[model samples]
Target: MDDPIMKHNVPDTEWFDRSSLRRMLRTYSLVYIKPDVGRKGNGIIRVKRLRAEEFEISYKQTTSLRSRDKVYSAIKELLNPDKEYIIQQGIDLATYRHRPFDVRVVLQKPLGKWRTTLMCAKLAPRRSSVVTNVSKGAKDYNLYRLLKGTDQRLNRSEIIRNLIDVSKQIAQILGSHFPLKILGLDMGIDKRGNIWFIEANTKPDCQGLKKIDRRLYRKYLRAKKIMRNG
Candidate 1:
């Protein structure tokens, strides 16, 4: 988020704490709190402002609280004190048939140059689900279908092109600092078709990607082989 160009797509994020949580809730109706070293959407929390004082929070289950202190206490109780957390202003994700989803773009360094290897839509199993993580019961769908056929308000081609470019740029930026060979970026599309940078996984799971696109999955395997044995 330090990059001026990248920060625009990145949501407003802050270290999870009472002050930051209260301040973000004042500006945005929804926010997400997650462990600093978490994956599979485990230990993630969703907070929504229902009224001036009343708030709705969802973790393992949904609950309502009347005060910021109460909300803080409730969330804190669910968190592991040994781990760190961050609060990010949530994106009102684009939905298909009322289920929210996000695009997962994987970029790999094949022969030492960054290129997008695969892209797929991870759809939440149900309407009320918080995270669209497959390990958390989400399903993968064809990205083109979700962006083009289901929704017309968004320019599907443009969104894909932009994210592809952004993903490559991100690989370049972060690769400069770390010896990274691959990056799995979680990109979100809001109800208005605007793209958002949700988060990135250094070691992304590509287990079921072949179910989305065989050719792309093969391309990913080739890249992995080249990077591993080159």
Candidate 2:
């Protein structure tokens, strides 16, 4: 999923390591280091290059200002020896009321055709949190309402169309190799209105969508029924 998106619209990402971390930090200024098998944004770290040699590593409730080597070592110590990690270029995501937010594009396969069923925005509770995971104190909002007054440079309707198209594309690509029923594409929109694929979730949680819009939730249920009947 990321491979197709990366070739086109998504941000640059690579496996995390001392060498790659140093290179990506130089290239991206701000990069995210995340565990390969973590959820709810747990064990995710945000690394930012501040000066020539100074950098910052921010994890849950901890932000450390240190030199390049020290920052690397600190991250290394926090990592599990057996688990893999990834380094991703961080996009300065769009903000709603001073808090960073990201869109969740939900796509479902009904009658063997992919359809975009739901679009919800998750806003971080605080500016310090690294992710907008609903489990991490993030609040869900209606996608259209969230984009209502913030930035008007980009056309909202067009953005929504693009998001749905890309999400369906991702689902189609992933479905080729596996039996994909639904996808929850975590997407970020930059200040410039460029949409980036942050990540993809195969078994997406719909609790946020249910809380935000029951109509969309009912639609989602109908899609699931089609899947089950088929």
Candidate 3:
């Protein structure tokens, strides 16, 4: 329930009543509507801001709407009164060559101490989508290739430090909450060099591990074994 990435010193998001949400949507520039208990990147929507005179809406299910009233009505009609949901602020992610991308950081607690096992870059599909979850058709790029590739503003040291620091911080926070032996964190690094907590997965994909730094992985394994045997 605690998301340090939410910022604003606000408490964890709570379920808003129907009228309250409408009022909030009118006030907040952007908001996300997601299932409170959903998993595997399902049932989430990034609602765009509505101008005083113009309003538009789009989703995976319905991509086209002509009028503001229609958009509002459609959103309201899709709401599930029986289910719990959260309204979150939308984050404008950093882009790579005009295409938005996010970083997928894999963390494992093998023995006891938390360690980051792998890091991968996920490029969102050309279509407009807020999340870069693979299930949502986001393409996975080689992490090292992207990092090592030419970008005048970014240096290798900065890239590594940013990812490493954020990964460790997120692992520390989640570990404090659940005391899990292993966990995977999917994080977002924005254009302004801000780190965001997208979501955490109990079972993370290890496919990208083979492509990441071997030395780091070895250290994690060695530390995990020591803790397990201790």
Candidate 4:
């Protein structure tokens, strides 16, 4: 049972501190800094390392820069060079309502095989945050409601089915590539409806099931018959 989330740390990290991070950004042109133990979208910073005479810093939708000495001071105050943190390449996120949003696809293996049960679109609040997690002030828009728009072109059932299919594809890839199951996937769909996996969760939240889609519980009743009928 290899962990899917752990697999993202492949080929070893070259740099891990603000100094190293800043240097890496200078060498590579861009990088993303995320908290290793952060949850609910806290302490995530996106920085662009540059070769400018006065280097710049950016995080959580705000961009700024200080002198080299000041940059080191900020890093010393903000990051733990010895602790776990990640500096990843940035992705061009897709937009929803003029702001960025991400999809949370819930998956489960009732009897033995994986199945997608629910999908949610978490939209970031206007001018408030970079993440769309509810704790970050993002709204939980009903996938069911979005499926009802005639002008949207995608039919209700088709939309749901596509969501499920895309989720399954991701799960299968992770299982084969990383071998972790029961993942809560944060995915982004560009304006063209292309799916991009942002990250995977080992512990997927079931509260959304309890609060939003209780009827999905009944699907488990058939779990007993999954192997027998298959």
Candidate 5:
């Protein structure tokens, strides 16, 4: 999945290793270390290189500032030896009202072809939370309205269009490799307006979309029906 999206300039990501960690941190300055099999942003840690030898690791509600080696040892202790982890270059995501947020693009292939159905923004409840997962106390906002009045380099329409195009591309590429019905794409927009792919879920949670806008949910249902009947 990462390879296919890399051509689209998705942020650099690599399997978690001590060497990769040091290299990525040195290059990106900030990175996210996440469990290979996890959800709702649980067990995800954000690591930042503050200086040549100083680092910071943040998880849940707490952040530990320590030397690079100590930070690595602390993180190593928290990991389950049997489970795998990944290191991803962190994007300085755009914020809405001082809280970081990411766009969720929902694509459904109830019919033969994939179609974009819903787009919304998930905002972190606090600045310290590393993820915008609704289960992590984040709130959903109307994608358009959320971008309204923001000082982003890209206008609202441009951002929406780019997201749709990228989502379609990802779905098409992934569909060729796997049997997929629906996709939930988490996307982040940098301050410079560049969009990056965060992750993709085959079974996406539509609860946020339903709660944020019933109209879109109804439309999604209607589209599903049309696809089924066709």
Candidate 6:
């Protein structure tokens, strides 16, 4: 949100509250609320404004339609009141076999220069999942094949190149502010092939890369070794 150059790729995001909620819902038809320090897609809430005075909120497997006045209460019921949350505009994620997915870009700064070492994706196991989180039962897919094979109409090559460029730029920009050696960025692409910034992970969990692609997984391990030695 701070960088002007990369901010444009980010979805509308703000602190989660009654005011921000009402204001954001008024501006955008869809919004998602997530824990500030959450992981594996837990404690996330999806809210959609169907029409005036009618709202829909979905969490995990349960979904409910609430009136305009009761929307907040419904969302609050699913939240752990102790934790802080962020409300963000939801993206119409590209789907594969009816399941939505998101891209994961691994950038490592070995001996000072930043480079994207690995690119993969996590596909949600079911259509109802609020997130495409691997730890929470999502399946890993080869980013290249997933983008190229399924979306026949899109320019997959261009999207891949753009993802690399945008991800590297984000790494460089964020690296300047934090003393981080590795970053796992969660990136999103809509059906129209436009890329969006989701989140940046300082301690990215890329442990099981072998399942997606053996070669890229080996490269990821090598990058980790180099970053560790330095």
Misplaced by over 4 Å in model 3 are: 1-16, 19-28, 65-72, 80-82, 147-156, 208-230
Q: Total backbone clashes of model 3?
A: 1
Question: 92-115 in candidate 5: lDDT tens per residue?
Answer: 888877788899888888767888
Residue lDDT tens for model 4, 161-207: 66677678768767676656467878765444545566678776656
Tell me, by lDDT, which candidate is best: 1
Across 1-230, the per-residue lDDT of candidate 3 in tens digits comes to: 35545342232244655654566667666666777766656777666755654554555645544344455566666667677777765666666666677777777676566677677788778647756777778877766676555332456567667777767777777688786766677666656656676667777765555546666567656755775786
Q: Would you give me the overall lDDT of model 1?
A: 0.89
Task: Please estimate how well model 4 matches the true structure, expressed as its whole-model Cα lDDT.
Answer: 0.60
What is candidate 1's lDDT per residue for 138-227, written digit by digit as tens? 999989888865433788888889889888877888899999999999999888878898888999989888989898999999899999
lDDT of 2 by residue, 83-194 (tens): 8999999998888777888998899989989988888999999977788998889988999888886643657887888888777777877788999889888999887888
Q: lDDT tens string, model 6, 140-217? A: 899988876554356888989999999999998888989989999999988888889998888888777777888887
RMSD of 2: 1.7
Record all residue pairs in model 2 with backbone atoms less than 3 Å apart, i.e. clashing.
none
Q: What is the lDDT for 117 in model 1?
A: 92
TM-score of each: 0.95, 0.94, 0.76, 0.65, 0.93, 0.95
CA lDDT, candidate 3, residue 186: 69
Q: Rate residue 145 of model 3 by lDDT.
A: 73
**Residue ranges of candidate 2 with Cα displaced over 4 Å:** 1-6
Q: What lDDT, from 0 to 1, does candidate 5 have?
A: 0.84
lDDT for 51 (candidate 6): 92
Q: Local error of candidate 4 at 10, Å?
A: 12
Clashing pairs in 6: none
For lDDT, candidate 2 versus 6, the one ahead is: 6
Comparing 2 with 4 on lDDT, the higher-scoring candidate is 2
Q: Please report, in order, the local distance difference test score of every candidate based on alpha carbons.
A: 0.89, 0.85, 0.65, 0.60, 0.84, 0.88
